[model samples]
Target: MTLTLEERVRLFGSPIPEGFTVRVVESGTVINDEIVSDTKVVANGYDLYMTDKVFETMRDKCLSKTSKVWGEAKS
Candidate 1:
């Protein structure tokens, strides 16, 4: 089952930043060429197989857009 952003935050008590998704996987599920037993975070070009706390912290830094960029995004 796929966990929505809101559901993830509420149910798992983890922050799922924008543009990312959480997926619940079955046992022996192949993810990123590795066998996964539980959940995975689907990123832009890859999947992150991690626990709730690690995923929460990583997503917060990587996808939250909280860091400053050197230049403005060009349209």
Candidate 2:
């Protein structure tokens, strides 16, 4: 099922998955390209955005750092 940004956000806090750190860069604009005048602006009409580089880095870290020891122990 396709999950909307709000639904996903409800299911998972931020765009960054659990157990990982995310570095968000404020481009001073919303994901829809609207200029943000205030830092207090919540993600009302916008989705939390991140650069491709950040996404890739998080993905790589999660994949590489997953423990294989749990599987070994189970077996």
Candidate 3:
């Protein structure tokens, strides 16, 4: 049962920020030959993901740019 953190916040009707992805995950680390585990959910280690809306928006913005930064990108 994997639950993402963003949904919890969006459940309250607050919009997520643009160009950013937020999520929570289980993490752990080893210290002094002992496994120090972070059982609490957190964000790290590529647990983050891009929203479809943000990806599309970024693609559109890149396609719309004509400043040569996009290198003649197709529409």
Go through the candidates in order and give each one's C-alpha lDDT.
Answer: 0.49, 0.44, 0.39
Q: Which stretches of candidate 3 lie above 4 Å from their native place? A: 1-43, 70-74
Worst lDDT run of 10 residues, candidate 2, spans 66-75
- Tell me the RMSD of model 3 versus the true structure: 12.8
In model 1, which runs have C-alpha deviations exceeding 4 angstroms? Answer: 1-14, 38-75
The superposed Cα distance between candidate 2 and the true structure at residue 21, in angstroms, equals 16
lDDT of 2 at 67: 26
In candidate 3 the C-alpha lDDT for residue 40 amounts to 30
Each candidate's TM vs. the true structure? 0.32, 0.32, 0.27
| lDDT at residue 43 of model 2 (Cα atoms) | 40
Ranking by lDDT: 1, 2, 3
- Residue-by-residue lDDT tens digits, candidate 1, 1-75: 886654555555455545556654455656657665434443335344555555455566443332222233423
Model 3 lDDT tens row, 1-75? 442333423343223334445442223433334332333322345343334444455446444443233255464
User: Measured by TM-score, how close is model 1 to the native structure?
Assistant: 0.32
What's the true lDDT of residue 32 in model 1? 57
Residue pairs in collision within model 1: none
Please identify which of the two predictions, 1 or 3, would achieve the higher lDDT against the true structure.
1
Residues 4-68, model 2: lDDT tens digits: 54444456634344655433545464545554433432243334445445556545544333323
